[model samples]
Target: MNYTAMLHTHTLAWFLMLILFIVTVILLKSGKAKGGKIVQMTLRLFYIFVLVTGATLLIWNFYWATGVKAILAVALIFTMEQLSTGIKKDTLQGSRPMVLWTQFIILVIIVIYFGYFVA
Candidate 1:
């Protein structure tokens, strides 16, 4: 596919992933493990989509700055995954989830900045 189309797909995938992440967290917090797990699984698929399209975009652009954005994107994904897992397992107590959430937000901001303005 062309760069424009690929970029749109990547954006859409990450948008949906973000929505699903919110839904999953809500469900988990509401004591609906089954529903949360289902949504979490869907979110994981979007994570794959985001990663694949992101890699494609990086391959097309192939710059050091884009590489930095890609790394930040990966880190963002890792934070999301870890946060969700901690929520599911009831391990992220007190300020732990807050810390992860903070990391997620910061990484997302950095990635978006690099993606839209820098790269």
Candidate 2:
């Protein structure tokens, strides 16, 4: 894909992931563990999409900002996996909510940073 198309796909995947994450969080908060499973699966797919497209975008020019964003994106994926696993095993601790929110906030910050400074 062209750079423009790739960038759009990357952004779309990012937004979709964020939306699904929010929905998953809502389901978890509402005690709908079963319902959140589907969304989490979808989120995982988006994570792959984002990673692939992001790597494609960076292949042409290796910039520090893109590198940082890529690292942060991987971290977000790990956080998501951890949170989901904890939720699934019913081992969610009191600190989980804090961790979830903090990760989400970091995601938004990265998004804004990319929008204003990187892309």
Candidate 3:
């Protein structure tokens, strides 16, 4: 696929992933582990989509800033996965979830900046 198409796909995947992440967290918080797990599994598929598209874009256009953005994007994905798992397992002690959420948000901003403006 062309770069434009790939970029659009990547954007759409991340958008859907964000929505699914919110839903999964809400379900888990509401004591609906089964439903949350199902959504979480679906969310994982979107993660794969985002990673694949992003990787394709990077391969098509390699640059130092883009490389950094890719790394940050991966970190953002990892943070989301960890936060959801922590919520599901009830392992997030006080402030732990908050910290992860903060990291996730910051990484998102940085990644967006690099993806859009820098790169």
Candidate 4:
């Protein structure tokens, strides 16, 4: 919590991001992962929103995306976009749960790196 630092990745942004993730978690838990088109579209919208916000964060919070963390950060963002597209057409490369788990892990790491390293 350095008082002098200015940032857009503050509590509110992360909270909104968390809400996006949580909505996905709930959808999956509802067995909506295989739900009708509406559910799938809702989930996709959530993912797209998350991806967009992530890119916005990367742009505005460029200070965080440096060193090895920089590469990881970009890869994470790309993966989100890839995932969103994959799910859009239901042509993901592997197991659905696996992708969801991997996405969760990536988000966790990005959040950690952003909070501790970027600042």
Candidate 5:
């Protein structure tokens, strides 16, 4: 796809992933096991979409800012997976959820900053 199209796709994927992440956390907090499971599965797809589109955009034209953003994006994804695993293993509890979610949101903010301002 062209850069313009890829950019649009990346934005859509980013927003969708953010929304799904919020929803997943909410569902888990509310003890909606079934809904959380479904949202988790769907969230995984959006994760792939964001990664793929971001990669395409970067490979099309590489820059230091985009490189940093890409690295942080991958970190964000890995952190999210770790959070999920923690939740499943019942290791993270109490204030841990808030801490992890805050980190995730901060990562999103930094990524967006780099994507829009630095690049």
Candidate 6:
């Protein structure tokens, strides 16, 4: 039961991911925001905050990560890059919304799996 504030870390990670998902949905729904810079700036700041928390947790608190979980994390990062490229260019030639949600769900499953199994 000794987690060293592990519950808080998991909660933060989940909460961050949820917020990230919602922000992305908003951006997608806005359809490039019709040249509005507000959404763009908001997204930029959100990305920085997300990366800060993600990197900090990765560095400060080691997770007994499984192969599935590790791969999913890498995949999530890759997805983020693809998403950024699409957002910046306002183009999505091949990506689909469903594919992203599927990947996101898988990542969430792995996170929950790790949360319960690793500790």
Model 4 CA deviation exceeding 4 Å by range:
1-5, 8-11, 24-65, 95-100, 103-107, 110-114, 117-119
lDDT-sorted candidate list, best first: 1, 3, 5, 2, 6, 4
Model 5, span 1-119: residue lDDT tens? 78999999999998899888778867876788888889988989999999999989989979888888899999998778767657655689789878887888899889888888887
Estimate, for each residue in 8-89, the C-alpha lDDT of model 6 and write its tens digit.
Answer: 6545655665565556656666775544345445555655555555455565655656444555655765565555556556
lDDT of 2: 0.78
| lDDT by residue for model 3 (1-119), tens | 78899999999998999999999999999999899999999999999999999999999999999899999999999999999999999899999988999999899899988988998
Tens digits of per-residue lDDT, candidate 2, 24-58, equal: 87787678888888888888888899888888888
Evaluate residue 91 in candidate 5 and report its C-alpha lDDT on the 0 to 100 scale: 88
Scored against the true structure, residue 53 in model 2 reaches a CA lDDT of 88
Cα lDDT of model 4 by residue, 3-103, tens digit = 22333434444455445545544554455655433554554565455455555545655663433454564455455445544554556665874875587
lDDT of 1 by residue, 1-119 (tens): 89999999999999999999999999999999999999999999999999999999999899999999999999999999999999899998788888999999999899989989999
Measured on C-alpha atoms, candidate 6 has an lDDT of 0.57
**Clashing residue pairs found in predicted model 6:** none
User: What is the lDDT for 51 in model 5?
Assistant: 92
Give the RMSD in angstroms, all C-alphas superposed, for model 3.
0.9
Candidate 2 collision pairs: none
Worst 10 residues of 3 by lDDT: 107-116
Clashing pairs in 4: none
RMSD of 6: 4.6
lDDT of every predicted structure (CA atoms): 0.94, 0.78, 0.94, 0.52, 0.85, 0.57
